[model samples]
Target: MSQLITEVQPDVEIYIQSIYQTVVQRNPHEVEFHQAVSEFLESMAPVIKKHPEYQKYAILERIVEPERLISFRVPWVDDQGKVQVNRGFRVQFNSTLGPYKGGLRFHKSVNASIIKFLGFEQTFKNALTGQPIGGGKGGSDFDPKGKSDLEIMRFCQSFMTELYKYMGSDVDVPAGDIGVGGREIGFLFGQYKRIRSGNEPGVLTGKGIGYGGSLGRTEATGYGCIYFLQEMLASQGLELAGRQTVVSGSGNVSIFAIQKAQELGAHVVACSDSSGYIFDPNGIQLETVKQIKLVEAGRISDYTLHHPEASYYEGSTNIWNVDCEIALPCATQNELNEVAARQLIDNGVIAIAEGANMPTTLEAVHILLANNILFAPGKAANAGGVAVSALEMAQNSMRLSWSFDEVDGRLKKIMQHIYQDSIEAAEDYGFEGNLVAGSNIAGFKKVAEAMIAQGIV
Candidate 1:
């Protein structure tokens, strides 16, 4: 660690320690939650030093503890007339900048600690986007896999019945994440509208274009990551053209990343899902990948069915060992570890951009920085999704819609601005192109200033 980063703010350190202890006591095995908290504290040390008033606010303590943690019993009837109940949570972490803006995840692992960590990260990430959105995250532990459409609809209605009371277009706007998609958003939004008894189009994003959704929200995160990587590569007189890229996850971000990389003349060799990964040395066929993952909703193992030449691996981590010029982890937190980082470094990978939140572990980040690899953290690189969501809100509020090209052009501009801002902030902080420090400092300053202006609220 750099001496500058090692100099901890005493109050911040104490607060972080308290959070760590409390979380550990509650969920001792949540390694990812602990890792997220540690990274937040490490990045926040400089913020505390620059804004001593943050200590007065005890922002670290307040941030660790959400403003409101809503957990409810979600009971719904299944297609078989069987009753099912699952726990749902919404952690409105902060509201300093504006209304809470974040995604609602629907995975089996959703919990208070996970939601808290995600919500906390969203605060800074949303701030970095220069958007008038605050931070909050909600989700449920109920897995949406294998559920009938009617069953899923029932569950979403049940979930939103409670969520709608606390959310609005100008209050907290939710979007899709992890297991939440167009279908899920449609159900949730329908329920919200029914309960609220009014048509509030801006209450959610990632809706189908027939609704009030923006045109480019689906591709924003992936395309934005490529834009940031392009800027980084350009700084070194390199380009994505002819570069070999590896992307993990077969979800929205990874799929669009593959498409954008191919459009930029890069050969994307690998993409993965929860079941495993598929490697196509001749470059993954984007259409085929889309059909298999998106249309079929099948495991990546089925990818070999379409192209027998492609090989399938049974684990997600193997994507990092495919020897590519660039690596993008679009899966989940800590997908890239020290071993994977070392493999990429040894293979001469030039750059790494996270398409997922905190995909690279702290050790992997340290190794990448030590090796001088161009790396863009998820907060800056993936802000395009949320930025476009904010734009969607604007469009909804104005009862307007933008053309696909227009929305895409705006997304590109926002992404480029975020990259340049991060770089400039890094240079100003004496790090000189270190985007990790740059993003942290850039995002921290905005939220800290907002908190100060809000007068300790």
Candidate 2:
């Protein structure tokens, strides 16, 4: 389990330091956890003074620790008839505002710190959505990249066999993340239904649309990021259409972000995957990208096969060097560091919308803010996925499905609300134009108030 709560402080309060020290006491070596806690806590000094009862009740200490951290082993037989074992985890971080809601990530790099950091950030992220979902995250060290369908199904079944005992429609509900996509979610949901013997579609989200999944769920994060960007720009009397944009990652978020941006008349010039990036000055061809990366599940280098006019680099990092009016980091945590941030500023990048969680390093964010570049933090911008997941849960509960347009409209409004709310929160605490602080302050306050109302747990 992992945390942030807020109000405003002209000074750093001792209570904030004490609570942060409480987190550092046990997670001293978990650097990601440390960073996540520190970022959230650092912005809560004013909040501490305003809500002294939070300090009296030890809300910070309790919020920083997971309500429950479940860990178990998942064993499955590989295609080679070899037994493979991987660690599985579900950190139910909080349920103050609502039941635990988050995504399950599957990758070789999954570990305690990564899960904690994600779960901690998720607390505020979910709060910002103005939804009933609280915060949580789960994943495993099992990499699904080269695994066969049988191996994946076997692993998913095993993972759910141990996990089902803890999950319920009214309890923790997990969707997809990094390695957990529609394929993995289908397998996981099927296994859960088989074990639970119920049609509890709400127990999991990001399911196949035919089976209780919400329309526009897949495209939500990417589209939502752009929607937020549009709102940000509109506030400045600017616009997104007819702009040169660069996006990182060829995954679900980036691909859909590129699509939505194009729909709005933006020319997406570059996009990257693990192998490298494809740059087309004529603007990226969505169909060409989907063919190579989505349908073929091939490397981005193959993009040249269909579009000879485009160029592909050997590594993804260099894609940041290309110039554009806007940048979207949809790749992974801290993908855009200080150097990459400088490159974007040099290219006269006017705005950045994060489509991935914590994509920009702290230093990178500082540079962007200092240069007066409009920035939308991932918690506020990339919230579309979870927002749509919550919509999916609502559909399951009501035994009804929303039309694509209906879902998209709701998502757009939610994104706009998140952006507007962040602005007011920032100004409320003297963090005007600082979306990083604005978002943190806005999301944390809601959860903090909920915790106070619920009393000490």
Candidate 3:
């Protein structure tokens, strides 16, 4: 019940407490946003000591608030000639680094709180990529899961009708998120082009390759998650090879994480979706998963249809019960809670890397850290997607595209740098191996310095 940030040392605790209090008071009942701000701030007591000027300039206070919050209505007609209306949102949290950039999530759970929380996390996630992009996020409560193509097109058109005005190549750039994949991105980009009357492919990332999309964009996040994990393991004189891994979510991130982990010799035996999870002791077949989830657009349970030897469970959280050496929560926010954390730890999970934003709850993270599990926060582990998105922007701006190998090599280097930076930042602050705190501090210092240099906005 008591405030978490105020539990630190007396001097630095006051600053963190003050900023979080302002966040909670200004945005009441936004527990997700508060949780995100708290996660970043609770690790920042060492940062405030290193950069006393952060508070002098109110950096934390200003950074926690959004630069702009745009909420709009999207109305469209369904296949049955029925009219539907949905609320849309775009929260440009901060632009101290560059133009506003993040994904546009389309899920039934979307709301101001979720958007704000995601945008706040994106701030540092973007920063960690070492790219010249800021943090922002947008979405609608419209679930595209069961919608027809025409219906989805109409909804995207209506959503972009108002969203296009505020976006541009060098301005705010929105990409794809949950339920907003290549199909949705294509629809949105087509509508943005129709309304704007030009070929501004730079306005969005995660686009199809035919339309200026960078190679490896789709696999970046999942691949990057493993790359960071690889680096983390190497730091401990270990490797992903021969490790049994359990990955949650059958989406882009999870699928590719399974792919890369397998390529590196890690046996990924399980992956899940909204319906439930499929555990394949023989190892998850990447192509089979791709066909079922991506091509067929079916639940992960269908994975069993391909390989009858695999097992399918009915509950999403039950995936945590499977014993494995590695656990990757590539699903939505707050999915892996304290109970799941304990389950994974007890089951001998030596490492947990997040491929989704805030997938691990704060309590879960504490449990993992307390048990000495190597934990990779979403910001550092899952930055490959945005890093490649930034690379896509670079290619588009230059009117050139790189080969798949070239793009993948660049992504590998960026992820390695991020891992090294977090390690260095943590070691410099006397908290070696505390990557969560180190990543937050490393990203915060960069943004705070830039904010101070630019003067108050």
Q: Give the range where candidate 2 is weakest over 10 consecutive residues by summed lDDT.
A: 1-10
* TM-score top scorer: 3
Residue pairs with colliding backbones in model 3 are none
Task: Compose the digit string of candidate 3's lDDT tens values, residues 1-457.
Answer: 1222323457787767788888899999999988998888877776777778987998988999999999999999999999999999999999999999999999999999999999998999899899999999999999998899999999999999999978998889999999999999999999999999999989999999999899999999999999999999999999999999999999999999999999999999999998799989899998999998899998889888889999999998789999999999999999899999999888999999999999998988888887899999998999999999999999999999899999999999999999999889887776678898889888888899999999999
| Prediction 1 global C-alpha lDDT | 0.86
Instruction: Tell me how far the alpha carbon of residue 181 in candidate 1 is from the true structure, in angstroms, after superposition.
Output: 0.7
Please give the RMSD to the true structure for each candidate, in Å. 2.1, 2.6, 1.5
TM-score of each: 0.95, 0.96, 0.98
lDDT of 2 by residue, 1-457 (tens): 1112343443446557767787888886887788787777656666567667777777778888999889999999999999999999999999887889999999998888889989988989999999999899999999988888899999999999998887887899999999999999999999998987779999999999888898899999999999999999999999998999999999999999999999999989999997788899899998888888778888888888888999998888788899999999998888898999999999989999999988888778778887899999898999999999999999999999899999999999999999989999888776777787789889988988888888778
Which of the two, 1 or 3, has more TM-score?
A: 3
Which portions of model 3 miss their true places by more than 4 Å?
A: 1-9
Task: Tell me the tens digit of each residue's lDDT in model 1 across 42-84.
Answer: 5566556667778777666666666788999999999989999
Native-structure RMSD, model 2: 2.6
> CA lDDT of each candidate?
0.86, 0.88, 0.92
